[model samples]
Target: MPQEAGLRSFFLAGFECATQRRADGKRLDLLASTRHDAHVAKDYARIREHGMRAARDGMRWHLIETAPGFYDWSSVAPMASAAAEAGVQVIWDLCHYGYPDGLDIWSPAFPERFARFSKAAARFLAEQGDEVRYFCPVNEMSFWAWAGGDMGRFNPTARGRGDELKRQLARATIAAVDAVREVDARARFIVAEPSINVAPNGDSEQAIADAANYCEVQFAAHDMLVGRLNPELGGSPDKLDIVGVNFYPDNQWVLGGPPIPLGQYNYRPFREMLKETCERYGRPVIVSEFGAENTARPAWLYYVAQEVAAAREAGAPVEGMCFYPVLDYPGWENDRCCDVGLFGDADANGDRCVYAPLAEELRRQRVRFEGEFAAANDERMTPLRREAS
Candidate 1:
């Protein structure tokens, strides 16, 4: 298998690994609830057959660290061993918006505790081996702050503390990166944040100004991590390594209003958004989370993949794109079946129902890239590139 710098593959599968508390004070473990935790080895092997050799999975902080300082690797070991057994690489997410009980987000101990947890996780994974090292210390910091703090939809449920929560998350993330580095200096961190575009409804200058400001808010977490917004967070250029951006159909909108439908006149160009992100961060990027529901999956992949290709062609250091939530997961709010994965729920044999449309599209894209995706100077890839092919 070939690699592009820190990534093992140009395409990757991402498991839906969100573990958070809901508004009603109920905990949601999508991985265990979906039985993904039970079939990590099988899942990794199967996706490798689909031509992807890398994945993004998460560690359940709440589950692993049952007690304050004690941890049980029983929950995360199987996945790490499975990836190695299958010869697949992984990018692990340390804190996917969930924390151990009795840990207050507002307390001074939150950052310290999270950092300690990061060190423990890194040490354990390093013991597993040296092949798998990429990590997202705190996944979706901006979204977490908004959903959990501003909107009061999840843990750390505070109605008017979005900025405060964001700052806290940034501090924790920077601390985690440093902790992981202490364990393995070779480890790379991918700061996964969402990319969004907002526009004004009318011709009013104030409306345009408001929309622009709202649009820039999407970069707050990243900016803070890079010490551009909040230098007090201990963030610097070192903390801003690989940029992992999540984008979706609902990511764009009229500021403070309705969503801008994908492919419509009001929708902004994703290629431009990607380019701007690379320009702003000065790091290689990965579309860490992107997919649509049910029947729209294929079309969405096609659109996103093309935009990613265009971004690469335009000289943005886009390293890879991950088909997020490669396995279908239960919705957090309603427990509904979100048919947005290449594979549906597993059966008695631990086999999942394949979404044929998505599988076919994935193969088609994979074949094309494997046979035709060489760059001007990057020769680590196989087959001829676009112009040559």
Candidate 2:
């Protein structure tokens, strides 16, 4: 079994904190949409009730840094304070696809300004009495690059500049890590990137090669961060600390084809994927973001937890699993409800109704992990007992 990854809990909750601009120039504040910002104290307390003592949350750069070189913590302090009070260890995302209004993402000033913001944020968190800090400097760089830079789906809205945007994000991530370390040397960083699998549509050589190449693209941001691909970007091994693999039900697909259904021959088992990621980076792995919609929630969690356990048995240091968007929020494109969380939308009194089935599954998995950890501890102490005898 794998050792604990220093988190307060093996299972974590993730609040959707995306603050990105849409293609039509509309800015999204998912934190506000989910009412997590207003009801964070109750939200944190609720997760703790479910036995989750850690979480993945975010700060809105666009809201915090309204102007150049000035940051107003009014938007973040309440959430941070709530987490501290609830005894939840949080991995805060510094950037989740949004930036300040006047900051040009393509210019050199982008990374410089981001570094300063990161430093300030770190200092502020430390001042709040957080001894150990975990930060995801820039969330999902690979996905962000493809969506915003290549597909023009969101902010920056550039076409055919995916690689360029990825490199820029990598630079900013490295700079953020350095800046944060200056304030808190014990700070750990998580690089959250989508974990995907692409298979061939047909047996043709061209199809196979295309599928393989497309699958390889998922690692570009991670590679750039560790100097494995781009040494000039100031990437080093330490910059890529914990590999936060964000997998979803639709993460695997045939190249240029439809998504591979679970249990299909073309669909890769998540355990194999986790093992591959661990071997590649040699870093502690965490399921950074994962959950399914509506009725599929419990089944999806069971599948992921089982696969994660299998991977750990195979010598992969799989640490933790996070159920992302633990609170349901409005869909990005349409304002319709996306019923994908363990907790439903907040009510008037700042309360959320828990989805009983998913919550029950989480408790079951937590008990199983606790048993495994205890067994592993006993195995480790056996030799010590013999020595003492």
Off by over 4 Å in 1: 1-5, 372-389
Model 2 misplaced stretches (Cα beyond 4 Å): 1-4, 372-389
Query: Could you tell me the TM-score of candidate 1?
Result: 0.93
Candidate 2, backbone clash total: 0
By summed lDDT, which 10 consecutive residues of candidate 2 come out lowest? Answer: 380-389
With a 3 Å backbone cut-off (N, CA, C), the pairs that clash in candidate 2 are none
Error of 2 at 165 (Å): 0.6
> All models: lDDT?
0.85, 0.89
Error of 2 at 373 (Å): 11
Each model's TM-score?
0.93, 0.94
**Best-fitting candidate, scored by lDDT:** 2
